[model samples]
Target chain A: MERETILSVRDLDVKFSLRGRKLNALRGVSLDLYKGESLAIVGESGSGKSVFVKTFMGLLDANGWIDGGSITYKGEDLTKYTTEKQWLGIRGKEIAMVLQDPMTSLNPLKTIGAQIIEAIELHQNLHGEAARKEMLSVLTDVGITEPERRAKQYPHEFSGGMRQRVVIAIAVACRPQVLICDEPTTALDVTIQAQILHLIRDLKEKYNLTTVYITHDLGVVANVADRIAVMYAGDIVEIGLCEEVFYEPKHPYTWALLSSLPQLGVKGEPLYSIHGTPPNLFYEVKGDAFAPRNPQALKIDFVKRPPYFDVSPTHKARTWLLDPRAPKIDPPEAVRKLATEGVKGYA
Target chain B: MPENENREVLLSVRDMSVCFGKGKRIFKAVNNVSFDIFKGETFGLVGESGSGKTTIGRAIIRINPTTSGDVIFKGQKINGKISKELDRRVTREIQMIFQDPMASLNERAKVDYIVSEGLYSGERISEEERKRRVEKALQEVGLLPEFASRFPHEFSGGQRQRIGVARALIMQPDFIIADEPISALDVSIRAQVLNLLSELQKERGLTYLFISHDLSVMRFICDRIAVIHKGVLVELAETEKLFAHPLHPYTRALLSAIPLPDPVREKNKVLEVYDPTQHDYSVDKPSWVEIEEGHMVWGNEKELNRYRDMLKA
Candidate 1:
């Protein structure tokens, strides 16, 4: 089945000149987003997951520049459209984004309802009574009670969960084709996090919108992601169906990520964390970015970057271990047990 | 209970209650919260936003005044219009590490001054002694000795937290209250800080009132667990027992809510929110009752019996 592609990114490269040194934030990262499918980009901090998404929304700081890449949305090149007028039409209308901190994204002076209504009016041609009516409907749809009164309430008046809900209401107010959520529930409590995830999932289905969820927490990605992209340093090391990625991971970095997850039933020992910090992006890498941290790194892995080796029809990983000539290796016992019990058949 | 019964009791808080505002519109932030932190043991306080865990931590260090309650340290009450002598004693014995290191630490103050601030108040000490203590504290937290001259803004989130810990530990406090110390840190740096805290606790025989919303981190570090909801102490039990078999419904709900790292368990598990309305708190008076050895739950006998029956079913 060939799904219609909503957005296609090719050879996206972002670099920052910090203290006279050029730091490559995103290096030749390419991916496709189909309509109504949720894609999760998983990595530790400084993996450029946030940078890639920020580029799409034109929210990157002045120091960052796209050296080479094309982000095509509906066959239109987004990188070339650098004018504020072009961005104003696309942002918060065709595509909306929700940031990690709800408080910062929301206006402190304005009421929650008023802020959402502003977004509605800016994108959609709703005005006065019509905008108010639509704002109430959107608030109610996002599971917020007393839409009439809450419309008058400010951001500080609502709890963390309620504020996030208001943020969601505003994001979805214009019926955006894509929602870029960057760690939307990271700061929230677990119960509230669950509600937010459920709300995002429900809204995605109701509106038939594509979603790009960026987060460090694999637990969040497991429940929501249809496909997962394992990013390291500034590159996508692996991309696969969620089930295959969780069950039979080919990349050593992906295996490490799986083992580090703390599970409910596993009781023998503490969760294993990936030792050593991620490599500095300021320096250029000759080979694999994860080779320094990967315990099973081969000589070829250090000298030359491995091409994406196909593991299955839907799975591919960038590692020398996936090569036919390379020595076979197995994931740690803890990860295997977790895969068998918890993560297998995730798709 | 006898006053001088056990030397193992490092800090005891009795009937601690704190209220904001006054008169008819008063809000009880903390209600009759009483718990003991043993010497050389980590006491975990887990709760949500409005649970008053932070308030309890603040009250113990005298950062804020308690409405009514005795914060007893080494068998002496230190609360309600404290004297300078008592304040000095409390400051020496108890220290606090705040959640946001950037906000807690003075941006303009150099690392040397920040670390020496605690020792500065104690007694007159030579410059050589101060330098030695500051260097030792910084080294203990894995920071460079030369960093003592740098300001807080120069350091990363993790390094700033290490500075915060160094500042608190230089006083050599018997009991330390860490209020969500690692919540602001990066995930990779979190384990490093936790390991450092654990190592420090073992070396110094320090008692910690570790307050955080993270159950997994608490499970790893804390010896005993106390669950607070709203303004009430809901449950208190040993860490292993609490994680293994949570008795209180709220505790169970909280435990289930922790998002496990495993994708499989994460998918299969359904975390339920804690609803106070479901429980019957109709009893005119409620008290803490021992459900088992070393496990205490707050509720009336009728409610306990009902809960027990429900669990059995």
Candidate 2:
């Protein structure tokens, strides 16, 4: 059965001009988010992952300008909406977001209850007692105990993990069709991080909402995402089912990302890290942005950017190495072992 | 374990405890934590926030006065009130690299000034000689020599960390406490910095108290592992042994929580939470006991009995 696409982004381009230098933050990036499924956008910082998703929530900085492309939500072009007033209706109601830092995202002055109730009241005509009731229930639903007491407490009173849970509660308050989480658990501890990941997954199921989870950790993507979108230098280099992407990654960059992750049970062997920093987005470039750092770069890779070559019906990667004419290069030995031993049952 | 041979005992933290405030209202930040770092070996301290890992590091360097116990480096005790002589010796022998490189370093200072600040207290050296030393330190950390002229903001996060390392190395300290040094770096750059630290430790014979929450990282660089939780050192063992057969409940839980790269195995592997009450330690005061050679576990008979009883349920 074909799933309904909740959000479809096409040829999306976001640019910034600083000190008379134009930088392309997102260059012709496109992907789809289906209802009731998670699409994880994975990449290192400065890979333009955040910038591409920020467009959905209308959270781009003042310097950022959408140069081209359209973001369609439920067949409506969100890019066409120019004002915050129009976006406010959808921002927290239809398309809610959970930012990286819960401390910064929440207002310290306001009580959690007040803030949550305010969120609920904005979309609904509930007032006073009724709004408070809804807010407490939402808090309880997100796994916070003693919802009444917790709702009255300020953001500072809660731990990093609890505050993030509160933020998730507020995001899910309106039953938004889409929830965008931007590195939601990056600052949290591993145990707390696992709980939060489970919470997000549970909430996604309960609400039957489409989720766009953006993070640098491939370990996170492997656990939570239904499909994976590998981004590099403001472009979607690869996109596939989670199993296919993890086990049979065709792109050298994806292979590098997979291999770079530190694994348990892999004793003594040094974890492989992708060499060289991500390229500066300021300069206009021909060929691939990843070619210079790619160990298996060919003459064609240097001359022009590779088109999206299909590996399977659902999996594709933008790499010259994917070309039928290009010579096939195997992944590093350690990575091969990691895929077979560590990543069993994925493919 | 091969690196354990020829390892000189550089720093030894014995029964160190640090308490904040006073009287009955006092909070024990570091409760009887103990470990040893041999010369030219990297000893990792792994724990989550509020685990008192940082307090242990600071106490060893005498940044914070220990409430009780001692931090012995070489043979001299380094804790409590610092005298002028002790301060000079401790500062010269030990250095620190903080988590946030940009915030730890002076933003306004040039790279050379930051690196040479430690040498300012030494006998007056020629400006040319100082510049040479600064450039040499930068080169050692894999940064370009010309970076000396640039400010902190000009460099990337990874470069700034290299600068921080260079600053510490310029002091030529025998032991260095790196508190989550690479936690702030990008995933791709983290390996570079780790490799750089590993190589520098080999070339310079520097001992490191490498502290981090990430177990995968700890496994790579550390020779021995110390697991702390809620102001107590729960487990200490050789890095490989600790990873292979983690005895303590917390250590086992910590090992289980490390996310594997493999998608399928990650789903199947259920990480058990660390329950401290499962071990017997109620008969005597809580302290680390040597279960085997170089391996320590916290709790005495009284607490251990309680834990054993709980496990029986």
Candidate 3:
């Protein structure tokens, strides 16, 4: 069956201006977010994973603007949305975002019930008793117990995990077709993180909502992602099915990321680390942005950017090594072990 | 298992307890926690938030006052009251690496001053000596000497964490208490910091007390792991033994919560939720028992016997 793309981004370019300097945060990025499928965007900090998704909902800062390209969602170009009024028509009713920190995202003074009710009344078009009923139902849906009593409590009265659940409740109250979770579990504990991931997955199944996860932790990505997109220096270096990306990765950056995990690492030995930092976005990037950090970079990689080469119908990578003339380089030992042994090697 | 008698006990916390407030609102942050950190070994203390893992780390560093019990370092008692010479020695020998790189560092101070801050407390050293030491420390952590002139705000999260490590390393301490050192770092950068820590340990024979909520990370780095819940330890065992045969229910739950980077296993995995109320310790009065060669568990007689059976199976 051919899957329908709910949101299609074609060659999107997002730029930010800081102190008279221009930063190419998202450079020629393209992605197709499928319906009811969870796509995880995995990258290091400053890799523009957040910037790429921010353009989807028109949430970029005042200093930032779309440089070029199109974000076509249901036949509408979101890049053309210049005013807050235009964005309001698409923001919560069409798409909603759960930000990284739950503490800062919520209002301290407002009751948790009032916040969810506000989102419910404004977006869902239900008011008074109906909105209040919906707020309680949403609270229960997020696994919060004693919804009636807890809803009246302030944000300071809740724990970190409970506050996150309230935040999730508010986001889901809008009944959006798509939900974007930007490092939702980064500030949470491991147990709480697992519960939240399960909750999100359950919510996705219940609502048939397309979910997009932005995280640096591959462990979290593996648990929830149906498909994975590896971003590097504001570019999608690799995109594939979760199994394909984990087992048969073709990009050096992906290999390094998988190899560096402590689960795959052998004790008393140094894990494969990507030396140096990510490339600065202020200067114009030539060729591959990851070329400087990549040890086995082909000469051509430094001169020109490699186009996406299809490995399989579902897998593609942007690297010169995938080209026909490039030399066949073996992946790191750890990544290769993962390919052959699967999870058992780590287990 | 090797004999622990011959091994040197670098720092030992005997029946230590830390309490906050008083008169109807007393809260025991660390309740009668006892453990010995051997020389040149990574001892992991794993727990969820509000479990007193940070409290224990603070108590050892003298940031928090211990309500009772002794914190013996080498041969002398370091906690509570001590001689001025002994206090100075303890300060010079023990150091700490904090969790959040962004919050731990002083925003206005240069890397040079931050790294050499410990040296400024004790003796009046020459400016050139302090500068040389700062450069050497930065170089040790794989940062360029020129980075010492820059402020903390100019660096990345990973770079800022390396500065934290450099600050701890400049003290030349025998022991370092790293409280969630890599929790705030990126995944790739975590590998860098972990490798750097192990490398430094091998080079200088430094002991570490690694505290974190993540069990998978503890599995990679720690020699022995202790599971604490609500300020009370439930289990202590070798890393492999803990993974192979987790006795306590809380330990099993914690291990089950670790998110593996394998989709097949992770998706099919069943989460074990721990309920502390399951333990009927009111009558039995649970006590710490060494169930195996080096493994320990906090349980009464009945629970201990069942744990033994679980190990056998």
DockQ of each: 0.30, 0.45, 0.66
Candidate 3: tens digits of C-alpha lDDT, residues A1-347? 58999999989888999999999999999999899999999999889999899998888888999999999999999998888899998898889999889999999999999999999999999999999999999999999999999999999999998999999899899999999999999988888898999999999999888999999988899899999999999999999999999999999999999998888888788877889888889998999888999999999888999999999999999999999999999999999888777553221
By summed lDDT, the worst window of 10 consecutive residues in model 3 chain B runs over B1-10
Model 1: docking quality category: acceptable
The sequence of per-residue lDDT tens digits that candidate 1 reaches over residues A121-155 is 88888999999999999999899999999999999
Off-target runs (Cα >4 Å) in candidate 1 are A259-276, A294-296, A341-347, B1-7, B81-83, B279-283, B310-313
Candidate 1 chain B weakest ten by summed lDDT: B1-10
Runs in model 3 lying further than 4 Å from the true structure: A343-347
Per-model interface RMSD values are 5.2, 4.5, 2.0
Candidate 1 chain B superposition, TM-score: 0.94
Per-residue lDDT tens digits for candidate 1, residues B5-91, read 353888889999999999999999999988887888889999988889999998888877899979888888888877899889888
Full candidate order by TM-score, most accurate first: 3, 2, 1
Q: Give Cα-based local distance difference scores for all models.
A: 0.84, 0.84, 0.91
Instruction: Write candidate 3's Cα lDDT for B143-211 as tens digits.
Output: 999999999999888889999999999989999999999998888889999999999999999999999
- CAPRI category for model 3: medium
Ranking by lDDT: 3, 1, 2
* Candidate 2 lDDT, B138-165, residue by residue in tens: 9999888998999999988998999999
Pick the winner on DockQ between candidates 1 and 2: 2
How large a fraction of the reference contact set does each model reproduce? 0.28, 0.48, 0.68
Residue B262 local lDDT, model 3: 86
